[model samples]
Target: MKAFNDFADRVRKEKREHYSKPVSYCLNYILVYIYEPITLNQLANMVNLHPNYLSTLFKKEIGVSFSEYVQKAKKLMKRNNS
Candidate 1:
């Protein structure tokens, strides 16, 4: 169990680094939007940020709003399903 826990911790750390490296709020938002299925307000709460501020940051970094990002992700999911 200890070894399994260690392995899980390592995997989590690597995943966090993979997401944090590029540090694009939009990408993070998109990923969370697709995989997590939470509201914008909930996501903002998770990150301890204001929803409007997060929205602006996402736009600045990704050149699109969170809604657009989620739409693109959903489209990709649909394409993959076929």
Candidate 2:
């Protein structure tokens, strides 16, 4: 599928950043919910973290703003017809 290829290409191109301790949990959460209807504020509340802090940490590790990542994911999902 084109969407899967896009996902694979992104995975191959973008090097993941390192995080530690409890914050790493957010990384896993982000990965699982990439294409879901979620926002930084929602995720911040879910993870019990401050919005600003979450945004900073997310961008630092993920190498993109949260909204940007979500947009790309949504595009991919649409491409895949999922």
Candidate 3:
């Protein structure tokens, strides 16, 4: 039973890590293309998720809406550039 519980815990952790992949990808893409225009739909398509779902997941993971995060990223880029 202990081994079974350990396996289950590991599985849950893996699933969480898997779910974070799309969010991470979006963050990296936004940072890499900070000057270019980006849309939720484009990112959703790139990540193979529905736009709405991605938006919800992104907000849940990052504590901000998709557009807000993008705007923040752009601002950060500008600050760093200067």
- The top-ranked prediction according to TM-score is 3
Lowest summed lDDT over 10 consecutive residues: which window, candidate 2? 14-23
lDDT digits (tens) for residues 33-78 of candidate 1: 5756756677677677789887776666556787787888888977
Candidate 3's displacement at residue 17, Å, is: 9.4
lDDT of 3 at 10: 100
Off by over 4 Å in 1: 1-36
lDDT of 3 at 56: 96
Clash count for each candidate, listed in order shown? 0, 0, 0
On a 0 to 100 scale, what is the lDDT of residue 10 in model 1?
100
Candidate 1 minimal-lDDT segment of 10 residues: 17-26
**For every model shown, what is its TM-score relative to the native structure?**
0.59, 0.60, 0.74
Residue-by-residue lDDT tens digits, candidate 2, 1-82: 9999999888876645346433467656766876667778887887788999888877877678878877877788678885
Q: Candidate 2 at 14: error in angstroms?
A: 12
Q: How would you encode candidate 3's per-residue C-alpha lDDT over 1-82 as one tens digit per residue?
A: 9999999999988866664889999988988888899999999999999999999999987779999988888888789889
Which residue pairs collide, candidate 1?
Answer: none
